[model samples]
Target: MTLNYYPDKPNSESDTAIYLFLRIGKETIKIKTGQYINPKHWNTKPDKNGNHVKRSYTGSPEFNVWLDNYKKDIHQLYNKLTQGNVAISVKELREAINSHLKKKEPTAVIGFFEHFLDYIQITSGERSKSTITKYKVLYKHLETFSRDQPYKLSFEAIDMRFFDLFKNYLMQQLKHTDNTLWKDFSILKTFMGWALDRGLHQNLTYKKFKAPQKDIEIIYLTEKELMAFYHAALPLGSKLDKVRDVFCFGCFTGQRYSDIANLKRNDIKGDRWTLRTVKTDKSYFVPLNRFAQAILNKYKDALRPLPVMSNQKTNDYLKELGKLLGIDEPTSLTKRRGNEKLTNTQPKFEFISTHTARRTFITLSLEKGMRPEVVMRISGHSNYSTFKKYIKISEKVAEVEMNNIWQMAEPKQEENQ
Candidate 1:
């Protein structure tokens, strides 16, 4: 195939739009490159009119590079289309060229998984970076799963059968937890929905595929336990001491680890703390309790409430702190995969991380008589289902709260008298 450009009209003015001509098999197709330049700067190898222009006047080097890249893109598309002796036509070529030119980064005819990753990249600025990272990780998992599949990964291939096979692979081959599998499939489903909305793929079998999730036991520190952890003395000037301060701050303020680690003095407004959440851009206002206030008072001379540390390092220190505080109670985790029920038990401290702080806040808030909606507002939770998940109410606590409710319903002693 050959690519060339010419003026829109034979006697067009100096500033006329240039259009592309593609010659294939037996047909020549016209494509509008949307590039306008002076006719005097036009270039034609051979033509009837003596307008045999060679170079453009407006920055020839840049224009030449752009033209060369455009031609290279078309040629690459042509080569990709001709692979496997596939039938090719001028209309298909034009459409392919159009698709290539429209992309922010042209690579090839993208498959399902690749296009999902591309979407993530293209909208990187609009979405949270961590969210994009999760999507990329999901893509990697999909790519690995596709390697062993009978067919290439495409939208049409993501039917119910493929869902079952993929779920089995994640369970038997990858050994993913029920929660992990559910989250991964959720991302996949989101991408598939996006593809459908954009009219990229027609097969909607994924819409009917159920992404099952078992109730995960949320492990968190109770009110007394949080106070115990708070007042627990650590070695002076130790990393554990610093991490404990930040972890307690998170528990009190209900901020995420990312937000806590990056919290600045400016974000703290007197007794009320205000800052936008990192995962979601929503802002929250949480009143600092005496415990959180005491920690900040301890570091009054510092720029922030606590010194920042890497999340991984903080978790590592937290484990040591938990062990120091004797938080080694036996805890069990159970999850269901297909016909198998998997269970694991270990010390609670082994599972404690920065996330426990937020969970502690929500659970303790509800335990302390805060309404679910109020706690949700403080925690920046948008939905009741998600808010309820973070609250770990024991049967004993439930009974006590219910009894209190009954007591409130009782008539006053003076009125009975």
Candidate 2:
């Protein structure tokens, strides 16, 4: 077996990563040492004592010591694995070395909630603010469930029994619908998987925990309703007018409330607006239609391209605006809590929210003959499963429109006859 260390980027002036190269028989493996140094400070060749880095440079002594110890650890690990007389490949050897090198610091014994907080802290940089907020919300729900039932929450305690208990608590006590419960359980499973990867516990019971989700009704404005709402007059310079414009901007551009709120004047170029979506962080180039462009021109002299409000305020005002414009078609929504199915019917205007704008854009776009792929591109939807819901809504709208067209055509044929 031969082992050597080399800079990842030998020609680079900036700091570069170092990698350990190992060759045993016909098997060769390269692994990152998780150390970085400038190319000038890194030695490509070993000296008389077979040391790649000399102790002359700053921090070189400590770095060399770590390298020496790392090599020794790898050799000792290989011998230990071979002494069992079991065939071991480079993959197994590499994994053992990685575990040894990247051993997590010993954490104090803590409850599940405390460990969850630590997980949030450590992974905050990797997750979006909204995602972290959702995780925190789930944490609160779990805390409440634990306190109410007096059940000890720990990694080892997460089993089929805990799943059943928590599932019942979410449905019976919290009255969460199937969809909401599914989302919460999904986040819980993600957290469990993360904890498991860190060697927190070997419990795999969460893998069997299932929370089925049901498709709830998606509400959006029809083309005629959207046009009427777009042209609805409000008091000039009023909050409602601003909210209408911002909401319509989202409807026209197929963007979320967060993205629309964060839209900048610099993001617009000609008739197109290119910006990264706040939720997914995916860049989308949305072409501005006549209506969308008009809204932009209306707010040309304003601080922002459009007068954007907080998501909550915008959603509140959208319902009010929808009601004012007489967009009051009745809509019904059905949801499930455990085995009980509950249905609620209300004026469609009452259901209008910031999210409705994007749905309206997608539904109307599909109904008006835009292909699903094109709509998905503008909406930044990579998953067909989620986008399929909008397609189903559009198909229903098309059926209704086709019936109307056929009814009108029958009268025209009779008149011609």
Query: Against the true structure, candidate 1 has what lDDT?
Result: 0.77
Residue-level lDDT tens digits of model 2 in 1-417? 788898998998766798888889888889777777767766688777666665544445557888888778777777888897878877888898778767843455676898899988887877778889989999999898775564557788898878998999988888899999999999999999999998998999999989978876898887888888788878878999999888888899888888887889999999999988766777869899999999999989988898887888988988888888888888898898878989989999889998998999998899889999999999889999989998888788888888988886446445554
Model 2: residue 265 alpha-carbon error in angstroms: 1.4
TM-scores, in order shown? 0.68, 0.70
Candidate 1 lDDT, tens digit per residue, 3-61?
77677875765456777788886798787766666555566554343233443342354
lDDT computed for candidate 2: 0.84
Which structure among the candidates has the greatest lDDT? 2
Highest TM-score scorer: 2
The local lDDT score (0 to 100) that residue 165 gets in candidate 1 is 78
Error of 1 at 376 (Å): 0.4
